[model samples]
Target chain A: MSSTHIVSIYDEELKYLSRRISEMGGTAEQMVADSVRALVSADAALAQKVISEDVILDNAERQINEKAIVTIAKRQPMAADLREIMGTIRIAAELERVGDLGKNTAKRVIAVQSSGMPRKLARGLEHLAELALMQLKEVLDVFATRSVDKAKAIRERDDEIDAIYTSLFRELLTYMMEDPRNITPCTHLLFCAKNIERIGDHATNIAETIYYMATGSQPEGERPKDDTSTSVVTADVSEASE
Target chain B: MSSTHIVSIYDEELKYLSRRISEMGGTAEQMVADSVRALVSADAALAQKVISEDVILDNAERQINEKAIVTIAKRQPMAADLREIMGTIRIAAELERVGDLGKNTAKRVIAVQSSGMPRKLARGLEHLAELALMQLKEVLDVFATRSVDKAKAIRERDDEIDAIYTSLFRELLTYMMEDPRNITPCTHLLFCAKNIERIGDHATNIAETIYYMATGSQPEGERPKDDTSTSVVTADVSEASE
Candidate 1:
């Protein structure tokens, strides 16, 4: 084959790999959304689907890695092309963790379903899930378009999720205190909220990654302060009450 | 200068950059530890130190990025070296976040110092702080040694911390229920526990990154399921009594 032909073949392979990783990100986002919904709706089948679909996400991660290595070995890509490939690998790994978090959410839902908590709690959880899913979606959109503006907006939403988490936590704590019987279900709901919040955090992580990839600068945020007051005082009353 | 000499200079620059990032990691780790101690002891000066030292961490991140760009543009590193550079950039970013979280914890300390809570509560929080420090130390050790086994072990400790958090949470809740006035202080403690827990989580994330750098495999350990039946029932009973 001509040298040109060989370069073209390598180019095709790289493009194919990029598309695959992007598709994987899309699927992982969907799984997280479904995992939350299944937990909220007690949809056992959807939960099962999320659990099983994790294999696909896992496979995609493996494929992205293999393809990158093969391309490096054969094509010996340099400079910008190499950065793109490495970025793809890093993003794939992050997305894969996001998928695992989703699967964990699904597993928790299954466990909660078995414990038989009231359905009302699930409705509140659904709100948290929606918020998380929306954030994830926005980050994915930024990745697709490489839009720094969109990434910045998504970063701001992280605080929103944090605020929602506090309220959700208070609500669940109230439920558990009202009825010991509510503990199992409330705990399940709490985990669901946590999963969603974590998903939001991961979304922020991805957005920051995107920001770096595009602008080569860290996302601007006020340096986080090292105060224990908010956390300590919050726990103190809860401890006293308990 | 000869091309060969230029190549050597590039190599040296990359090495220097790596060493600086490593030093930054060490400094950030120390800052986090000090911040936690400050919160536990209410040491205003140490808290101020943590906040000030964060400037150094920020500068290290900026230097790493600048060096990576210079290396990429001037030397045009090949695939593996390129991956290493990118990985360094990403790891530095994660470490920067760890530093910010530490600062956030320290800030909370200042915010709650005047809340008039018992000093004993700091003991529980101190435990969390120790756990986070240990995790951070382990993760950095794994990074330095590239020990997959060490990374795996650190991953397990995440679960242990989670268990502590659960018990501590219950204890705090009980305290709040016992005296309504304890609510404010208890809430602060809860946030401290959470920040420490999150720091531990970030440490685990770094461990996962180390694993990826070493073996290209995602770390093990599924997310734990939430089991809150006992706590829920106890909470309910406590509420009824109130």
Candidate 2:
């Protein structure tokens, strides 16, 4: 083959890889939305649908990985092209985990359905999910556009999700402390919130990956983190003592 | 350079990749063990060390990833050589996540330390961590030996970790329900336990990767998963009302 024809074929393969990533990103985004919708509406069928659909992301990741490896072997892509292929692999892996987290939230629907979840708690969870979904969507967009600035913005906004999660963590604990009956439901909600928070973290990771892929270095300094729930001591013995 | 000379250099590169993976695995395993020990003994110092040491894994992952990409570009390795390089990248990512989970466990040390953890609860967590650590170590060994049978066995054993985590989850919920004072500590401990469980999941991921690398196909049948904690309901309103 002529050198021009060889380069063109490589370009086409790269484009196909990008398209696959976009499709995978779209599926992941839908799963996150539907999982939260199922949780808020107590829709087991929708939740089950979300759970079953996770395999799509799994299969997508596997295909993308195989394609990237084969492309490298065939084209021997170097420099920027090599970085893009590697970034695709990493981003696909992150999206797969995002899908997994969404499915996990869906799995909790059955448990949350059995218990009567309070509107306040359900609303809190919904809000967190919305934020995480927004972050996921934006990062996916960043991946498509290769916008380092937007990626940095998305990275910085992760603290917002973390802050919300920490507050919700405290709120759920308070509910659990207020009534023993709330423990089962609130515990599940806490985990649901946690899953959403982790989804946001994955989005942040994608953002960082995009930044690295574009700039050939990591983002400067650490991304700000505001999750202090780990060390929070909300229940005082004297306060809870009757 | 002669063809033999070029092939030998590629072999050396592959060996270096494997060595880096082993070292990264060793650090991840130690981080897991030390984090659990810190939690059990309330040793903030050890937890701090584990937290600080997580960067080593992070750096190792980046180095391994860059090295693999470069090796592929230079060597254009085919078939099994290509799969081995890809497998190394995937396993490195899993090990990095294992390290993250351990550091997260370490981060919980201060909160668990303040609550005066019950001996029984600590022992439960320690036991769970032991199983997870064992899984991690065994999977790393499987990676080195490329033993597909051992990898499959390790993959099958994940349910044991999940079962233990579920029982621990219920036990923690019961303790929280019994006394509001236990809420904060139990919540942190619950997350710590979750982290350990996730470490097991990562190990399982590594085993699957190693199996795929050896056989060029996934292990058959769905791996058994026993973590039903998501759907578990332990709080009975009637029982608690009295």
Candidate 3:
């Protein structure tokens, strides 16, 4: 094949990898939304569906790894090309974890349903999930477009999710304190809130990856974690702020 | 340079990555051991050290990413060679998380010590950390050697950690139930136990990566997570298992 043919083929491989991540990201975002919807409504079937469909995200991650590894072997892409492949692997893994987080939340839906629903918490969770899913969708687009500015902008929104998480945590703790029966279900919901917060972190990671792909450097410094209330333990008591 | 020289150079790069990982693993392992010691002894200074020293692990992970990315771009290795580099990135990330887990556990030492130490829980945490640290060390060796047999053997022990974790969960919950004052400290310790459990998961990920590097394929199915106790939410009522 001519050099142009070889270049075009390599380009196609890269394109295919990006498209897979976008699809995976879309699925992951949907999972986040659906998992919360399941939680809020106590919809067992939708919850189960999210749990079952995680394997699709798993398979997408596997394919991305295979393709990226093979592409590096075949094309020996340099500089930006290499970062793009690495970013793809990183983003796919993030999306896959996002799926797992959503699935875990879905599982919580079942647990809460079995115990009995705490209706007030559901509204808070839905609000938090909406913020997280929006971050996920925007970060994924940043990945696809290599938009560092957009990525940085998305990074700022992690705190919003964190702030919601903090408030919900305190509210859940009060509920548990008020009613012993609330303990088990609230414990489950506490973890679910953490799962959603983690999903937000994964989105932030994707944003950082976008920054890395565009600039050949990761975002400097730790992304601020503003949801301080649920910090189970840390050296700084300040991190336990409400 | 002759092809021989180039191959030798690539070999050196792989060796360097292996050595860096080993060093990082040792630091992570020590962090685990030290954190548990801090917990058991109520040594705030040691706990403080682990918390502050996490920046080292962070730096190690950054270096691993830089080295792996550059090597892939320059060496453009195929098959097992490519898998090795990818595995390094994955392992380094896992190790970094291990460090974070240890650091978090150390933080719990401070939290619990401030409240008052529950002596019995100390022994249990020590035992779990020992198991997890052992797994971390052995798995890092498996990664270096690409020993499929060793990796598979390590995967089995994750169940042991999970079992310990499960039992520990019950013990802590009992503690929380017994005294209202115990709730905050035990809650702190529960999250610490979870951090250790998660460290074990990272070891399992290394085992999985080792399997993939050896055979160019991931393990055929899900690694058994015998940690039925920490199933915060699940479909089965039985999952609130003994």
TM-score of each: 0.73, 0.95, 0.91
- Of models 1 and 2, which has the larger lDDT? 2
Off by over 4 Å in 1: A1-7, A42-59, A69-80, A100-124, A147-191, A211-242, B1-7, B42-59, B69-83, B110-121, B145-166, B173-191, B198-242
> Which numbered prediction scores highest in lDDT against the true structure?
2
Give the clashing residue pairs of candidate 2, or none.
none
Q: Could you give candidate 2's per-residue lDDT for residues B149-224 as a string of tens digits?
A: 9999999988888888998888888888888777888888989999999988898899999998998788998976
**Top candidate (DockQ):** 2
- The TM-scores, chain A only, for the candidates as listed are 0.83, 0.95, 0.92
Deviation (Å) of B83 in candidate 1: 5.4
Regions of candidate 3 where Cα sits further than 4 Å from its true position: A230-242, B230-242
Error of 1 at B241 (Å): 13
For each of the candidates, the C-alpha root-mean-square deviation to the true structure, in angstroms, is 5.5, 2.1, 3.7
- Per-residue C-alpha lDDT of model 2 across residues A50-150, encoded as one tens digit per residue: 99999999899989988888898888777788888888899999999999988998998888887767788778888898899999888988888999999
| Candidates in descending DockQ order | 2, 3, 1
Candidate 3 lDDT tens digits, B1-242: 89999999999999999999999999999898898888778898999999888989989999999999988877778888998889889988888889988887887676588666666788898889888888988898887777898888888778889889888877776665454455556666777888888888889988998898788888765677535663544232233323
Docking class of 3: acceptable
Task: Quote model 1's iRMS.
Answer: 6.4
How accurate locally, in lDDT, is each candidate?
0.70, 0.87, 0.81
